[model samples]
Target chain A: MEAIYIILAGSLVAVSCGLVGSYLILRKMAMVADAISHAVLPGIVIAFFISGSRDSLPMLLGAGALGIITTFLIEFFHKKGNLQTDASIGVTFTWLFALGVILISTFAGKVDLDQDCVLYGEIAYVPIDLWITDTGTIMGPRVLYISGSVLLVVIAFIFIGYKELFLTTFDPSYAAIIGINTTLWHYLLMGAVSLTTVASFESVGAILVVALLIAPPATAYLLTEDFKKMLIFTCIIGIIVSVLGYYLASYIDGSIAGAMSTVAGLIFLVVFLFSPTQGVVFRNRRSKLSMTLNEEPI
Target chain B: MEDFLYFFSFQDPNIRYVVVGSVLLAISAAIVGCFTFLKKRALIGDAVAHSVLPGVCLAFVVSGTKNPIYLIIGAFITGWLSLRFIDMIVRYSKLKEDTAIGLTLSVFFGLGILILTAIQHSGNANQSGLDQFLFGKAASLVGQDLIVFGSVSIILLLVVGLLFKELTLLAFDEQFGKAIGMPVKGLELVLTTLTVLAVVTGIQAVGVVLMAAMLITPAAAARFWTDKLTTMVFLAALFGAISGVSGAYISFVAPAMPTGPWIVLVISFIAMSSFFIAPRKGILYKQFQQRKYQKQILEENILKAFFHLGEADEQYYGHRKISDLISQRRFVMGRLKGGLQKLVRSGFLKQDREGWVLTEEGKNKGQRIVKLHRLWELYLTEYLRIAPDHVHDEAETIEHIITPEIEARLEKKLNYPSVDPHNETIPYR
Candidate 1:
């Protein structure tokens, strides 16, 4: 029964990331999401210093605000400084992450966050930190509550703003010409990304969060061309990898997030080499078959 | 101050290894990073840094020891594989380079975590310091580690020194290198191999986490100071060595602090300061240039205004009221007053009870301004086919910047026109 709760918690985080990540992959801004995931470390540390508790509203808000600021700083460097997009993203995130690490080390005793948690995360302990009501009712894991709420928020954002997001991601100039607020949609997507990263940070550390955010959508991208199908495929891949990764970690007594990301990578590798239409094997086989057919005609 | 003295005095033999190891690591990474930075493959360094984790872990698992040599070999192999995979993905798939890098980096790091945690769970005591590879612990710089790092660093430095011209050509123009039959692909392979070796060599000092910073930040900071390849590479290595030694010393003073993050923070500070303060290309330098241009534009505009005012009257040296001059140009009162004072100080204008007027020298200078403006307008209209009405704004900007040589060329090209396209007189000097 506890295993069921853990699976649910992992799936919620994975699906939320998958939903937001689908848009990120389509926008060709997967790296910005990676930047946000790492940049939020300083925000989390500062939030912990203020709240003095593992669970607090200030932590979430701080992470959200810093995530947006990370976006703004990357844009500033990429535009104002005339840097390559990857370079700007690289410079900003590494600086923020280094600062966060320094702060964590300096205040090691005061801060509940540790370097290990920042890297591999404590998702297996999620089921242990449960929330109980006044009536002695077990309300499942609190992480499930946070991550599930974030998933609903992300789904609502995508559902309500689907047309605007689609138009902006595919053709921003056209969206602007048609009177849609393209910048507003962009910030909205970034906002969803920040919220999703914060919600998932506890379940998967900063490093593996990048994998969850990129791998599923990237794999689904190889399998399909339709946008809607891509989103669905990413969610399915995300949930399966989460469950599979949990069991793999349990079997090997390893970090659940790491195992999950490894599983996600394995899934991508499979799709990369063996997808029916886009796989290298099939593409090669098709070419060979065409050659043989032509030779038979001769 | 005492701690600083003790660190630099090198009284402790252990400290000597750390200082020497860090400087070598810094030089190798920075020199290799210069080429990577110039090639616009900066993020590949990040990918390689992260991808080295599995190699380190596998090296430990295979050897059953935490030896630096095996770990470095493992790191190089995986790091090289990551780059090859990235190139292959970009060539074959529709996904972009950033996506491929993010994917490969995260996947390899995740696998490393899996192996590392598995090793930890097995209750292996030797695996205690293995976690240091993640964030790096420079105090663990044993003599053997320093030897490996130092020798590899020397090899990297020598290769970069010998092939300086070839590497520069490959960085700036790959097509040209190929056109010249310079074995461009083989040179690229050598550079990639060196980048992997540099990152692997530095992993024990800065750790896998911040190795990318060690690799790229010094080169990036050095870019602000020079345009020449040799100068940039040398400056980058110097900056790298400085940051590395200082960072190692910092950890010595504050025993609790990690050396990798300190080095990264120091290099980041250097890069940020360079961005704002370096000569020629720094933000402050560019701002100064812009301000100078703006001031020159104001001075030339004032002279042109005086010339226009004098053109209407038969007496070219007559007095004009300060209020009249301000109204003609419609500049703010404060700025106009400052310009008038500056002209008077330079003996170009005089301020008497009547108001303001150009001096004998000022009249000649003002006439020259009007002549350049009208000449540019004529050049724009007659030669460039611009309408006479559209040339004023163009001439207004060009009048301040056109040197006497360019002015002479314009005169020769336009056959020394007597008037502009607007039929205004082209005053002679």
Candidate 2:
């Protein structure tokens, strides 16, 4: 029962992150996602300090706002200050993350969060931190409800904005010509990414959230040319990673989030080398075959 | 107050070690950062920083002790491997650079965490201080750590100095360096090694996460102040050293505070300020220059409108109504009114009951603008062979920017043309 709950928690995070990450990688905003994952640290800490509670709503709102601000700062620096996109991302996220770490250290006693927890997360505790009602009814686990609702919200967002998101990701100029609000959709997508990131931060840690956000989508991208198919593959890969990663963690008696990301990386490596359509090994072999055929004048 | 004095006095050996080690680590990272910044691979430093953790854990597990040398070696190996993996992915796959970096960084960090937690559960008592690489332990820098940091800094500095020219060429133009027979590939490898070394040494002070700031923030801030490579490198080093000392002093004053984040915060503050206020390239300066240029373009357009009106009637000094000027060319009403009033104040125009007329000084300026406009149109049609109709919009923008030197050169180039491609007389003072 505990193993089921833990895997459910991990799968919930993996699915949400994988869905949003599909759009992120499609739009070439993977680093921006990474930046937001780290930059939202201060927002969570500040939210905790102000609300004096570990309630999900306040933390999500705070982290969501910071995530938006992180994107805005990166864009502002790139467009206004003439800084390169990479430097803009590096400078903005590190600064905000540093601020967050400092905030946590200063209120070390008041805040229940620690640097280690933020780095690797405590996914094993998912089955332990139960959600109970005022009527003395016991809920299975808080992480499941939190992550499940988030997955639902992400699904709803994708379903409703499918056309707008698709057009904006593939062809922004055409989308603009057709009178779609590209900037609005961009911010909305970023907002969704941030929401997913903050929600998963508890189960997967901030950095590993990036693995779930990037690796599965990237692997899915290699397997197909169709965007919808890519997204579906990403969710499937996400589930596989969670289940396999959980077992790997238990086998090694190590951090579950860490094992999950390691599995994510391993899966990507396999797909990266073996995907029939896009694999490097197959590509080199195909080229060699073509070269020989040309030389032989067949 | 006494604490501040005691901290700075370097009287205590512990404080001395912390301050010197931090400054050295910062200076080396900052110097390497300038090269990465120029190459626009600043985020690569962040990837290398995150990738070092697994290496650190692996070294500890093998050695069964906290040996600085073994840890540094482990960190450098993984850090370098991460860069290689990113390069390989980008070269072989359709994934872009950003995706490759994010994937590599997170996966390596995740592996590191897995090993670190495994080590902790192994009941290794020596693993107590191993986690310090996550948030850094600048305040706990003992003499042994200082020696490691000092030697690494010296090695980094020496390599950077020796290969300064080759690295600069590699950063600015790799293809050009290759064309000139320079060993561009070899230089890139050397620079990559130096970057790994810098991150490995600096992580002990600022930790793995904020180490990116030590590499990138100082270089970014220094970039706002200069265009020369040498000057930028020096300024970045100076800024890095300042932040390092400040971080050490801050932790000294507040024992509860962590050194790494404060160091990052101070450097970020410096960078943010530089972005806003540094001369020439700073945001405020650019905004100011843009506003001034906009005003000049407005005033010049009004002058050109007056010159066009006078040319239509063969009355250069005749008064023209504001409505007539708008009919000639479009202008925002409020901006036009303000521009007209400002022109009057500057003695460029005279107002009377009928409308406004160009003064003697304004007539020459207006005529010069019209001449430059017609001259550019002719130059484009004759030299570049652009269509006559296409030249108007291009000349309209170029006329505002053409300096007197370019105007004279254009006249000489065109052999003093009298009529533009549109058959309008090229006005002259």
Candidate 3:
């Protein structure tokens, strides 16, 4: 029952993150998500230092701010300074992250700052802390509720700003001139991303955060072109993997986050090989089959 | 800084092994890196670097001792598998290049981590330095490492020397090489082998992950200094040598500091300097050219005013009110005092309380700028088919910078047309 709650919350978080992640994928800012996920460390560290505790809302905001700054620096270098986008990102996030590591070591000491914790979260245990409510009635794990709220917010924002987001993703220059505040929207969208990752980090961990953000949405993308359908399929895939992943991880006695990520990875692989629209194997076979049929004596 | 390389000599047989080992490793890896950078395949260095981690761990698990042969073989196998996997994912899926890179990078590395933790939890003391491959573990290069590094280096260099011409052709243009019936796939395989070898060699010395920099930044920096392929290869080799030697010396001296990050620091410094200071394509040179052109534009405006002064009234001869002559440019009056003073010393113009005017030499100089400007306008409007409204400003910039060869080419291309798009007569020299 408890594991079921963790799996549900985890999948909702994946769905929420993936909904925003599709546009991010097409915009070629996948690494930007990677950067934010890493840069959020300092924010997490600083927040704990200020409130003298971890897991606070303000810290999430602070991390969100830093993530946006990372985005800005990436933009500044790639656009204004004309640095190659990938290299600029590589330098920025790593430097900031190196600094964060140094800070945690220097100030926080090695107590809670293990590298494993940074890479993989203890998702199997989320149900233990988050499920029991004040009423003593099982509210299920509350992260599922929080993730549900975030999903609604992201889905609403994506809905309201669909045309503008679509235009910016396709032709930024055209979008810029058509009176859209591309810069403002870019940062705001990045903030939503930051919050999504930081909020889910406790449940999913930092490294696998990108898996949830990228994999399910990318799988949906392979199956469909319509944005709404992509979002729907993205959520369905997210849920299926979240549920199946919990059972699989328990079966292997592995870390839940690892199992979930591997599950998402496997689903992506299946879709890439078997999806009728864009599957590599399917496409190649279809073409070969068609060619053979054409050569037949009819 | 120069003294640091001295601590790193292979002279004392005690250190001789390390020196002989480090130099060969650096040189060969760098030579291979030059091609990787040229192919714009630097990030593949990063991918291969991380991908080899599982190999290193697997080697430790299989061999039961830190034998160089087992580790190298293990690292190479996984490293090779990663390259193949990266190819498969990109060829088969919608994963973008970086996405594929980051995905493969983290998953392999994470899996490596999980395996390593399992090893550590099992209480194996020998597995201690294995994670150093993440960044690097330079201080651990003992006598055994030197032999491993030396043999690999010798083999790498032999491969590079044997296949240099083919590799160069492959990097420069793959399609042309293919169309010419060259061995594109074999050449690509050779290049990948070299890259993997360079990456694998650095695991014990520079470590694995940061070894990518030893591959990437040196070649990237070397690119800015020269256009010739041979010179680029030499420069990249030089930069890589500096990183290898300096990083080793620092690790030796500091004892606690890792060699990998230090090597990256050195490579980054060298790369940044090249980006800003290289002669041909450096940012500073580009800025200098732009500034010089701006100064020349101002001088031309003065010259144009003096040319107009040639046909003005006698009363205005000595007292040409600079105000009447000031046009859309409008800054001529403000800065022309010092410029006109130089012109006067050059015996090209005269200036006094009656205002300013032109001498014979000054009038001739002004006529030349006007001639270039109008000629450029005609070239644009007649030959290049620019709109008439756009001709003037386009010519304004072009007249100042176009080389004599360029002017000649434009002139011949336009067939020496006497009149411009604005119907102004072009002055002939």
Candidate 4:
């Protein structure tokens, strides 16, 4: 009975992560998200230190705020500084993350936080303290409610901005020329991603959270370029993997998040290699030169 | 300080274990990283570092404890799997290689996190210490660890040494290597395995977050100092070993210092040095050489100009009244004065009681500069697709820097035309 609830919670987290992850993957922000995840550690630590508690409100707010800050800083450095985008992303987040680790080591030792806690969290055990109480009937873990609410917010965020988001992501210049606020859309996209990542951190932890945010949507993208189809495919893949990953974790005493991601990674591999529509051969050929040419223009 | 240095020698059994272990692994990883850095997959090492976590976790689970052998096996398995998955995503999906790397990296790292949290909850002290694998605990390394690492290091080195020729060719020009019937895929796999092994070896000393540096920065730093692959490999090994031992020594001597960040700090220092300070290609050196060349060209041009004025008038055209001519000659006056005085002593110029004069030799030299400058301007306007008025600035620089080889190539490619685009006469050498 409890296992069913764990599956629901896990699936909810997976779908939420995957949906927003599509945007991140499309924008090549997966690594940026990875960096943001680490950078938020210090924020969460500071919040916990202030509140002297591990509950949702302060930690969630703390992490979310820092996540947004990390997003802005990464974008800021890439735009303003001389470093290339990837290098900027790497430097900002790693430095911030290292600072977070050092802080945890120095000050948060009294707290239950460590780099391990930052890396891993057990969703099945989340039910130990968080049980749903409805009409005096004990029900799902409370994480489902929190993650589900955040997921709904994310879904609404995506729903409202779908066309605008697509336009900005696909062709920012065209969107700008057509009078769409591409800059606003970019921030909105980043804000949504950061919030979802922070909300899911305790349920899945920071390190593996990137896999959820990236792999599924990428897998779906390989399956099709149609945004609507891609979203649907990604959500479905997330749910399926959530259930399978949970079972594998339970049966083998392995990690649910790890299993799902590895499975997702495997699915991504198959699609990557075998996708008839968008395979390596096409990409390789295209890069070699323009079409209908006997040889490249040396 | 003297006592510290004396004790720091690997001759002591305690110091021996740490130094030898670090040095051997450093040598192995540095050599592998050299190839990856050249391939421009430097950040893939970063991705692979984060991607091996879940495997390490699973290894613990499979062994029902934090067994080193099982953990290494688990880490290796997942490392290979992660690399394969990343490759597939990049190959098969619409995602860029960066995206795939980012995705796989996060997912694997997150999974590792999940398992570790579960282990912590299970009340395993052994599991708790496994967290150090993420950042490293170099101080705990002992003789047993050294033996294990030393054996693996030797094996890895031998394999790489035997396969160096193929690896170099594969790195330098993949198509050429494949054309020569080299097993590209097989060699690539071997390279990947070596890279993963390097990352794994580093996790013990530098930790996961900083492992990429141990793999990439040494090689990057080494490249600045050498062009030979052999020298680069040797230098990278030296840098890597130095960083590893420095971090280890710091941790050993100072009880609370973590090894990973220190190692990273050292490697970053090396990278910074390579970027600005390596000889020949160093920014300061190049700028210095360029300045020197410009000065030489200016002096030569000035000498030629004075001679032209002299020849055109058959007098020391040193009309002290023409300030523009004097200013134009200002740049080269110092060097040209020496040549001028000799010309006067040998009676090539007469003191006109004005300013200065040039002999016939100076006249001819000045004529060549004027001729070369006009010819280049004409060439730019003609075959090289420059606008008529756009010829001056480029000619100014090219007149200073154009090499003999390029001059020959320009002459031939332009079809040896007698007149330039601007209708200037061609001066054939």
RMSD of 3: 4.8
Give the per-residue lDDT digits (tens) of candidate 2, residues B36-58.
Answer: 99999999999999999999999
lDDT of 4 by residue, A121-223 (tens): 5676766756645667776577888789989998998899888888888888999999999879877777777677777777677777777888788889888
Best by lDDT: 2
Candidate number that wins on DockQ, 2 or 3: 2
Instruction: State which candidate has the highest TM-score.
Output: 1
Clashing pairs in 3: B10-B16, B136-B207, B319-B354
Clashing pairs in 1: none
Measured by DockQ, the strongest candidate is: 2
Lowest lDDT 10-residue stretch of candidate 2 chain B: B136-145
Mark the regions of model 3 whose C-alpha exceeds 4 Å error after superposition.
Answer: A1-13, A31-156, A170-184, A190-208, A239-257, B1-29, B61-66, B253-257, B309-322, B332-351, B379-390, B403-429
lDDT of 2 at A270: 95
- Candidate 1 lDDT over residue span A1-298, tens digit each: 7778778888998898988888888788887888899889889889989888777477788888789888887787566455567666777788888888998998899988898888888888888988888999998788888888999999999999999999999999999999999989989898888888888888888888899999999999999999999999999999999899999988988888889989999999899889888887897899899989989955
Report the error of model 2 at residue A259, Å: 1.5
Candidate with better DockQ, 1 vs 4: 1
Native contact fraction per model:
0.55, 0.89, 0.09, 0.39
Using TM-score as the yardstick, the better of models 2 and 4 is: 2
